[model samples]
Target: MRVSSIYVDGYRRLTSQKINFEDGTTILAGANNSGKTSLIDLLRVVLGGDGNLRAEDLSASARFDWLMSLVDAAIEGEDCFRALLEDENVFEKVPSVVVRIEVGYDPDTDDIRQFADYLMDLDSEKSSFYFEFRFSSKRDGMIAAFSGLYSDIRKAVDDCNWRSANDAEPGSSVFLVLQAKVDAALVNCSKPEVFFSDESYSNVLPMSTDKSFKRLFNFRAVKASRALDDTSDDKSGELNQRLIAVAKEDKNWEGVISKLPSRVVEAIHDLDIRKLTTDETLRSLNTVIESISSTNGAKQNDLFLDFHVTEDHAVQMIARAMQTRYLGAGVPLSEASQGLGYSNLIFLHLEAESFIRSAAQEENRYLVNLVVLEEPESHMHPQMQSAFIKHLLSRVNEIGCLQAAVTTHSSEIVRLSGIEQLRVLKSEEAGCRIVDLRKFHTEEIADKPAETQRLFSFLYAINFSDLLFADRVIMYEGDTERMYFQALIKAHEELAGLRAQYISYIHVGGAYAHIYKPLVVDTLRLKTVIITDLDYEKESNLSSFEKLKPLLSTNATLNEFFQDGKKNSPPSVADLSSAISADTGVALVPDTELAAVAFQMQPEGYARTLEEAILATLLDAPVWTSLTKKKWKTFRNESGLKFSIPREPESPTITQIVASTSNQKTDFMYSLILNSNLVEAVPPYILSALRWLDS
Candidate 1:
């Protein structure tokens, strides 16, 4: 049976919190001091702890207030306060911690069910059972207290709705419902002095140090700091020591050691120098022993310094190196380059796995095999972090019927391990809060509306796992925009901080950018900024272009494009560009009524596209002239030095010049930022969007 969930209360910051687990690997991720370590410690205590709860395990914030108040109330000798003391008496519950675990078993797995039944005292009818273990100073007293109230307990037991306890089986009720209630009521009693004897706790069953319950549950924890620390050959290396002990204990090693030759007693007898050199000192002692002896046997015995041989002292490592080359060229494990430390730790885990597999080969295969890891990504770079988790998990599963759980703060761990396996802990005013990402995903979307499911499906197909690493996200349209935006953001000092934050720029394009709204806003709960063009598909009013072309056509430098018959009639650029240039002219119109209808066919109205948005930003006459001449030099001018556009800017003249030289809007924006004075000319909406995302 697997531990489906852990309910920890009255221990450190884990004041009444439940963390759920899956059969496979579950990743615990959270900020520092959010009780990630506390939860791991609680698991170690409840599942495999050796003794009763310690005083230091009491909640830090609640300890001082509780003890001081208890002292005050006892000194004052207030009976009423004692009567209502269950809610306030901190010392009574200070050393008391409760860990309740829900053991889940599959119906097909009879062995697991039988194992759970053996540990939890559950019948076959119960597919799942919660074993509540209370570790406290009053543990032994509580059992005695319940026996004292057995008459009242029997009456309550008869009155209890037995059907409620056996809801699954209807008629089977073998569990002690009476004892459970008596245990609860006595512990919940106001006066601890009257209810419980003043005694230190003796180890309790299932949660105690005894191996009786290990047939069902076992835990192995790899600490978070293991990655940075080197594995020593001394006593400080716990993992190393554990594996070495296991190797020494194996029957194969025992059999092999038994075959080795040893010195016979006859051969050692020849070296009895004690008899040859100590005759003077032993003569008087032998005479006294002969007179005082009561034994009938005539043999005499003398004490002397003795020595025996042991495998550890006899066998030694003459040479050791990691063979990494084809012909056995070696490097010492301690001095190996690349990811040797991480690789070595994984090797130790594999050795531990060998011991576990050996245990499974015996009759204890029903026992839970668990591997608990804390921050396995410590010294790992991003790539190594991803590779290590993948390999660790794959190897963990290779050992039959094993479960793994990892606690990490690495974004690579969160992303590569799969979002569904995440168990997020948040420290709140109430207590430590745990969110099982798997449970939330399953429950929230199982019966969602069809439209909502469709959006979820789209997101699932693309996978937002990568975005889990980003602090904030920028959603833009197409490849060209992504390219230029990166360059633009890098060029500007105001937006440069985004690189450090790992701000992700996602190219969802115009049509699909809105599809991510629910994912960003609801699911992932990320801070996101969407930059898309307000696009329209109608033709520009040729009259607006027609009106401005001739007026500016008189200038000799712009004659090729804007000169009446010489230029293309519909405008050389696309319809959206044509509409934006026309709209700029319309904004200059004296009457508001005429200007409104002038660009009516534009898709997103005024400034409907990126080209339109940038064009609408008023630029200095000199800046505009310089940008147009540069665009011509880059895209149209043959000799690279030749300029076909004018060197001076007029409102309509600059508009026509830009429309002639620039084909794509992204190209135009890139050229504009690079050549012109962009600080005074970037559109307010664009800058505001960037600033808001940065904030």
Candidate 2:
């Protein structure tokens, strides 16, 4: 049976969360120290047969924080402890870690047709039965049953004229009687073997046995840091012990030992060690001991190591040191470069696959395997990471009743795998949220798998980790805008707190800025502003401007500012409004609108780009001179056009030169910012947007 979903409550960093598992594979991804490890470890702790929350599992800082919380609760009153017993919230909860696994029934059980009938006729809530288990700090379940007995004992105390103890149910001798009963139950309790079902439920019944549960659930964990000590003596020794156990179970070793060219097995068995242990060997040894004792004038004593065949037929069989030599290099594997790392990682996976396959065989039917891997791409290059993840997935598909969960930060692995396989773990103040991309897709685009693949391909090529964790994001046009914004933010002291808010500035090209609307604004649910330039191939056609006018007019908010008569006479100042789409959290704003708020150089204008807006705001003669001089020295000199520039640096000529440079204005902007000590004023529109984002 496979696990459909896991509901965890009061596990470290996981207050209350339900993480759904997709068939085949599920990847948990997040930033460092963001609780991805904790979530994975907790899953192993729950469904894993011997999983438990021990003190050593927690970090030092977490332990200290937990202690301080308890201190505060104690100072508050007894009500605080009682709240913990109730487990209503994170603070009040004891180790009330409850895990419920929704199990999917196997088809091979009972008759396939009968099972299908049973499933169809079962209750909606009862169809998918939950295997639930919980952890509590104190004995809780049996207390209700024993409370009546305690009350009776308290009343007996009152009748016996023990007035002082009679007033206190707890202080009376009743607790002694309770302890005796508990001890007696522990010593002699035996669970009864019986089955019960409601007569009304003819088609279906819920049943579980310890043997069946054990056979159907298994968990194995391979941590990223585990490869470092794979070749340790203790580990190899354990392998030897396991090998011996296998030999004893099936006598498979006899077949391997029989392959010797000569009679090696016969020669070894011909030692006659059994005959050497007879009474004659003992007498010979005793006579020699007596002769030595007579010569030394001392009494003889019997002290010797004994060798005897035990009742269980066990023999002492020791394995020699493990030696591995590289075939190509003819060198010891440990001495080869990165050989230890590769050997440990590769062999562990091989062993895991072997174990899984063996467990699923006919003789070992009903065994279910859950393999957990942490950073399978560790110490591997990009190509190897891609190959390993692909191979792992393929291998898992070939095995039956096997499920795997991997935690990774490798974007290459993510790209090689499908986007539908990702489960993003985003840490927040409340707790970590696990977002499955399959569940996060918008309803309108749910059926379009090709479009989803296209989007994943585009996002994979770019480094967009910042966007996944940001509170809000501004989507600008290109690198030029991005560079200037980065520099401007450094100089503006009023925008200091903005850095703490985790704001991201992305360079989404003008034509495709709206494509990211569903991802950043819909899936992530972040407030987003699109800063796009008005492009009219030529000022005469006005194709883009005409298209945008109608789209903006469709929104009630935008209609008030840029619809009807206002369209013909477009606002010279910045044009800002909410998007005309159904999503309310996103806004489609023009570069002109932002420029007007940042600088007063424009009234209402068209085709005014970001660079033109910045230049218009920095109208000072020296600032212009510095910018132009840098441009000529860096870019113009390479083009051999520096000699044509006038010494005075006039506005009309300089403006033409600045606008006519290469397509990318990076060299000029980088040189201008470095050469001049002047602080560029934060554009009014940019400042207004930042303020709005903060609010």
Candidate 3:
């Protein structure tokens, strides 16, 4: 789930404003003094936030005063919404600030409809939605004067079907039968994640490790900053060492190392391959912690990787590493840089991913359902910041985490992201005016590579692209898997929704499956359906598949591919060609059967053969151009590069067929034209592959 929209009313600098959220990563943008902070506050409060400020309280009017100071003076002098209160003097000028946020979920996987169904049942099926919000004052002074203001609005939304399509309420229903028109506009905003404001967020829990959860084996990072900041009085480094020492808690490194699948781990990946080069990486972290704890009073300066370890020299480094501006070149712990590193979006991704993964392993993944990041772009290079945002959005599926809303000042960041996910904030005549970027402009920017590729092709490619098919995308690693998936779907219509017709199945090549998988999972911010096999066609290829089998599936083993086939399980291209009577461009090894051939040449051959086979099977050319290289080359230059041509007009004997287009220079027509007999004989797997590619 992702925040689709946010609406603010009667709270901060101005009046009522509603902002829609984007589906993927979003960048919140506004100039300074544009009520950016108030927008943040409104989001925090309305989305199940605990704050001391209440709208009805006279003493709580100071926040409004701040708003007035930023806005007009007449509004501050009058009390329109707060006429009966002590701060009523400024109330007339202060318009009511109501914040509304819309949330979106994967349509295929959304449970909001279920929640809506449950709510509809509660209302005697009269309505699919209801209103519910708590408006208690955060502070005692504000609480004392706070009337039943919260209940009033709840009652209004409950009874009032008066919501315009534009005016979405917090408690909008989902039941189709009751106010279905209005219900369609009402978004499915449910539980979202909350995060600290900054490293200095005293508003909630400090990210410090708690002893209560120690038994859960919290995967604590031994950070360099902690070491740099560790003094005699402050011992985060010592704490980390205690946490990581392995031997201190009636345990030792020896035992821990012994328990690990060291040989297997080494076989899987080299330490050098995974080594952290930058101070920002997690690999160099443990070393920093060790260095910090070893010293009597190592300051932030002593902990920075630049000061201690170089790329070539960091071989001795260990643990989580993050660089802070305060810990830059040299600085003591007490006055050390605190916010610079943790304030970054990169840090958020690392920690949040870590937390989510750990929780998933423990089957408590719901803890990561909501993630709140405040000002993730703080001090980051714009590219790095955008990269961090992309990573975060993509992680939505890896951990099953729900919502992520980040604040940003860079329009470049916003422009780089999808419009569906953005909520632009601005201070208007009222408080903060929120604009759902997806709705704001007919013309919008698509910064993503895939979208850019699509747009480029649309503008210049002379053809439409696959992205035009759906609102969502499902990625595939290669043509074979793509084919298999499509074939399965075609074979069984129940799974047709998983087909490449609507879903974009990118075949980034087999070698890239591992890299492509995470990249797809991360960038799309959605969970992936990885179904691959070590089921190679030949025995020799088994070793090649084994090289990547570890990355393919956790359960993959040597015997896993054995289908107990008494004979050849997967046929080769030659066999497939015979089966379907389809000449799949390339010739297969002599005796290989259909499935093997399909697996090897299915993806490319299908397209190469299918298009030519269907278009026309033969191309006519003069004998001089056809046989002589010099004449043919000249003719090729004059005749345009359109090599796509027809095959033979009719089935010919081998001698006749081979006589034509047998030479390399003359094979264009042969390459273009596919043999129908071959196509007719192509195996089902290869056929499926062809259909998927063409589709």
lDDT of all predictions:
0.52, 0.50, 0.36
Mark the regions of model 3 whose C-alpha exceeds 4 Å error after superposition.
Answer: 1-3, 46-49, 54-118, 121-131, 134-346, 358-368, 397-400, 441-695
lDDT of 3 by residue, 247-350 (tens): 22332444644434545346335644333444357446767676777687654433323232232232112323321223455753432334344334334555
Best by TM-score: 2
TM-score against native, each model? 0.59, 0.63, 0.32
Give the lDDT ranking, best first: 1, 2, 3
Worst 10 residues of 2 by lDDT: 595-604
The per-residue C-alpha lDDT of model 1 at residue 7 equals 74
Off by over 4 Å in 2: 54-95, 106-128, 137-214, 229-320, 328-336, 339-341, 363-365, 442-444, 448-474, 482-506, 525-607, 620-658, 662-664, 673-695
- Residue 27, candidate 2: C-alpha displacement in angstroms: 0.9
TM-score of 1: 0.59
Clashes of 2: 12
Where is the poorest 10-residue window by lDDT in model 3?
182-191
Candidate 2 deviation (Cα RMSD): 10.7
Output the better candidate (1/2) by lDDT.
1
Q: How displaced is residue 579 in candidate 1, in Å?
A: 25
**Model 2, residue 439: what's the lDDT?**
75
| Candidate 2 residue lDDT tens string, 71-182 | 3443344466344334545423223455556656544451223123223334544434355544443335323322223344344444554444223243336534433443
